[model samples]
Target: MTGLRKSPRRLRIGSERGSASVEVAVIAPALIALLGLMIAFGRVTDADAAVDAAAHAAARAASLERDATGAQARARAAAEDSLHGDGVTCQSTDVVVDTSSYMLDVGQAATVTATISCTARLSDIALPGLPGAKTLTATFTSPIDTYRGRQ
Candidate 1:
């Protein structure tokens, strides 16, 4: 033997197979988490818009009459209709009407508040990072001054 050096041989732990599964395992969780976040954000955005619209509408209605109770109900309905979306379960929506002396008096301002709550349903899947679902709430407020065509 003339001073020869041996090179290390390459070893195959298994087959060229399990790599795909390993890659999927690593990426699936992140993908699921991202999807969940997107859905939650979308729901929150919708709720916020609905609440704002309801508040504004309620205030306008309240300003028209001496009593704000009826205005509150109409505003709630409008808010619900605004927030209607596909595959969304809406609940726990509250509309609050605050007025001076429980009535809208001429030259008196009243505050209208609208709250919208919603949840996105996400069933457990391959990724454990994503929980069952998520809940979100949004609120809006506006003030309107009572007006009577003339003194």
Candidate 2:
């Protein structure tokens, strides 16, 4: 009767020694860059969503106004407030409201369009060839009350 003996598996350390180190050295920077890119895109996406919300709020505010001048003012204020409330700090923010439909006669379909444009600062994200800021824009339209009278 012979006893079974277990042998250890040999590791080929001659050619593969330090291979993992080399791989890390080669891939670390690329992985880091990819992470940075994803973060930048996420920031842009957040800013885009914020802009869209601001535009919708502005349009709705404008549509509820009685006069074009007041509508424009309300739209601008609503957009700025919405962006700020959402924590979207923009380097520059612009709100453009089209209140031409206010001139339409009563019982006619009227619409208010609001465009929100914002240049969001991206200093936190460090990536080559990527700008320090990105501009996000959104437009929304809201209808005025059909039976509302115009002054």
Best by the lDDT measure: 2
Note the Cα lDDT for every prediction shown. 0.56, 0.92
- Predicted structure 1: lDDT: 0.56
Cand. 2 TM to true fold: 0.87
Candidates in order: C-alpha RMSD to true structure? 5.3, 4.3
Instruction: Give every collision pair in model 1.
Output: none
In model 2, how large is the Cα lDDT of residue 23? 97
- Per-residue CA lDDT of model 2 for 1-151, tens digit only, reads 2345433332445558899999999999999999999999888999999999999999999999999999999999999999999999999999999999999999999999999999998887878888999888999999999998765
